[model samples]
Target: GGRTPRIFKIMIKRVVVINMEEINRFLNGRGSISSNILTGIMVLNILIHNKPSKEHIKVGRVFYTNQGSRSLSGGVEAWQGYFQSIRPTPRKLMINVDLHATAFYESDSLVQLVVKILNKRSVDDLRRIHDRDRTKLEKCLKNLKIFVTHRGE
Candidate 1:
């Protein structure tokens, strides 16, 4: 069979360098943190603290609590388990995080969180997600805003 093959072009957009500080300021004000902001900060905190190098982090399944923080189990080792679960995720993929609090208990949230991390995103991307997820994303961004702008010693 000597049929001519048609070539298809696939374009991959280059990821520009993200200035975290500049992004923080543009999304929210310089000061103050609300409950939603707290949630946003928590989300960003997970992304920032888990791995010092961005390359090593994978925003896999993310979990969250609506009212309070997720409870830690089995001491520090749980964090190790947490990271292991999300390791297989690809380098950068945006995710929807309007998951209910119960999903955290089921370990699905970790997967979602990984999706958020690998994608290199801010709350603006939340525009494409569900309304509830967008609300949550906005709040988390607000929270992250406070942390980035703080002038504490």
Candidate 2:
């Protein structure tokens, strides 16, 4: 008697650009590759959520908990802001976490598999399956929240 919620499969690709000038300035000439990678990952995470623009791409310093050191952090936010400002409609972004990191390593292949799954079924078909498995999705979402919150604290 109840309507089913839609299950949309999402694929995300990220690009990271590091500013050497800003990094050197922030670190005062003391920086490492791990620091840079963590900074990039933070920026990517923020941009995916906020979606900035091109004009705001100038590099600057920002703090990140994961980096544990000073490094470049502000450019991606600026760029995402600029992009969002120009876009006619807001973009919806979703993130999928891979426990095994296999999706990160084999992104293209994993994306193709997702696409294939979606292409094989219509939206209505997915809704029917979701309706049949409502408890499963709800349980998974609940478990995910618990897992993330546990790690956060």
Q: Please provide, for model 2 over 38-132, each residue's C-alpha lDDT reduced to its tens digit, 9 standing for 90 to 100.
A: 56446656675453233222223211121122222211111111111111112222343321100111112322323333443433444345443
List where candidate 2 sits over 4 angstroms from the true fold: 17-25, 29-153
Residues 4-90, model 1: lDDT tens digits: 999999999954444444334434555343444444545565675456344332235433223444444311012221222211122
Per-model TM-score on C-alpha atoms: 0.16, 0.18
Candidate 2 clashing pairs, residues 3+ apart or interchain: 51-80, 52-79, 52-80, 52-81, 52-83, 53-79, 53-80, 53-81, 53-82, 53-83
Q: What is the Å distance of residue 152 in model 2 from its true position?
A: 34
